[model samples]
Target: MTTSTLILPGSPEWLRYFSASKVAALPIKLDERGEYTRGVSRWESPFSLFHRMAGHLEPEDPKDEFTVGHAAELMLAALYRELHPGWRLSPGEVQYVRTDLGVPAMATLDRRASRGSSRRVVEFKTARDANEFGVDGTDEIPADYFIQQTWQMGVTGYTRHPAHLMLGMSFFARRLFEVAFDAEVFAFLLEAARKFNAMLAEGIEPELDDTKPTYETIRELHPDIDGTAVYIEAADAQALLDSEADLDAAKSFAMGRKSWALKQMGNAQYLYVRDPGGDHKKDVKVADRRKNSHGSVSFYVNKKADLAAITGGIS
Candidate 1:
């Protein structure tokens, strides 16, 4: 079966049911909020989400693009089945309900039961044939897809989690990856969805995202406006200055540390810091120092989190 559109061409019942296709669309009313915005789609931008939540008019995407994308998603689903044997993937049956946040929501899978009876959801994504693989391993999904898959899990009651497959059509290669369910993220999404719906119910407008589209939208909203000046609180001006100063200081501090590290390994392409052990060999920290093709020097540091540590501060 083919995927359904959230804003299907139908009667009022259509508004109550949301499909994955409309995740990016701006929300129109409280009744339609969950169907449009609840799922974790890359379309969930701060600006777009706010507009959707506040029932503001969103910039329209080209009809051609929308149709092409939908077609691509369907084709990818077929390709997935052909590529992976024993996977019972099918278009999801959409169900509309009042979510815990008290807003209408739905989760429709592009293909379900990706890997056996696990009931795992599979999200198919198609990228430009020219785009390079994001991670070193072909099994890793990009950040956006991870969020999308997790969101799918959140709404589908698939606490087992979701798998994502990205297809680069130019090469006809597919990358399969899985994301663990995050309770915190799911809870946050529900709360945020509720808050946005509440804003719509209360007739409150959300702040616009600082983006070109929003700028254009603002211009259109105030088109042919007579010139006028608005007053701001002195505290706002002071806060801006303070923030700039703090950023400048952080930049200088980071630059100094980078330079110092570079100088310490002047002739070497890598630096190894040895932490000597009392009764064993030293534990070494390796950092890469290399020159790019453009003659620009680059440094690599281990930025991964230390799970053993109590705090997020660098160890």
Candidate 2:
């Protein structure tokens, strides 16, 4: 198969290519026309990739307000141009299809830019707050975004790329992080994609992950219950019961610890952990309690805690 790079993103021709954004229908049915026949695309985040290969339906997009992601998509190119001097930026999406792998794969890069002889694949992202980017005043790219960008680099044959992360709806904070392509990790991702394609061809479903998305997908898969009961292996049934008990115990344990912490907090709005003889200025803030407009109190831990010092690297 020859690589195709001419198809525009979201075009009818592009729809024929496999995309993680497209919802997979349930009952193990695949669209005969497009998705089932095409190769995987870099548009897949790890979560969506797993769901796609597992034959799980993608969740419906929320209909409420315009999302941060939507804003980021619309503004990424313009922002990139404004931030980087002497770089020539392209406006449209750059698509790539690689046919050399065991399973052919494709990707759609958000924008491409060049400075002299240097070229880069650029991706854009948005976060609710700075804490999501990092707690210790550093930008940490999320794993899924890393994988997506790395996949894009692999597909486009770019050695390095930069991901621009925007914080908040107002675009209050912006940070650019560049990533280098990793041959070993990209090889692993390719192998995984190949196996996923195999599973799809063999009509096998991937094992479910313990995630809300998976739970929601399962719920959507069987919306109406038939009056039939299915048999389960005794060990599987026992495991389910054990999991339920474990969840309850974990909840109770967490609640008890929280109650004790709250009691220790007393009338203080913030809780701290300090050295035996340390000054207030040197104290480590642990958690804080705040009252909302509804007259209800909420407690949350400090995101900047040095977990390695606290847990001795156990976690």
Q: Pick the candidate with the highest TM-score.
A: 2
lDDT of candidate 2 at residue 137, scale 0 to 100: 24
- What is residue 226's positional error in candidate 1, in angstroms? 5.5
- What candidate 2 gets wrong by more than 4 Å, as runs, is 1-59, 62-66, 73-79, 132-139, 160-171, 233-235, 262-272, 275-285, 288-297, 302-306, 310-315
Model 1 lDDT per residue over 224-315, tens place: 65788888899998997998999899999988988898889888886654433332234333466766779998787644423233322445
TM-score for every candidate vs. truth? 0.54, 0.68
Q: What is the lDDT of residue 75 in candidate 2?
A: 72
> Candidate 2 clash total?
0
Q: What is the C-alpha lDDT of each candidate?
A: 0.55, 0.59
Task: Specify the poorest-scoring 10-residue window by lDDT in model 2.
Answer: 20-29
Q: What would the per-residue lDDT of candidate 2 be over residues 1-315, giving only the tens digit for each residue?
A: 223457644444443344223212111222454333222232333344445445455434664443546556667567667778878876766677767766656676666778888778776666543443553223366555656666777667777544333333344456667666788867766666665666566766655544455566667667898899999999999999999999999999989988998999988898877644556655667788888779989877777776455445644
| Cα lDDT for residue 304, candidate 1 | 43
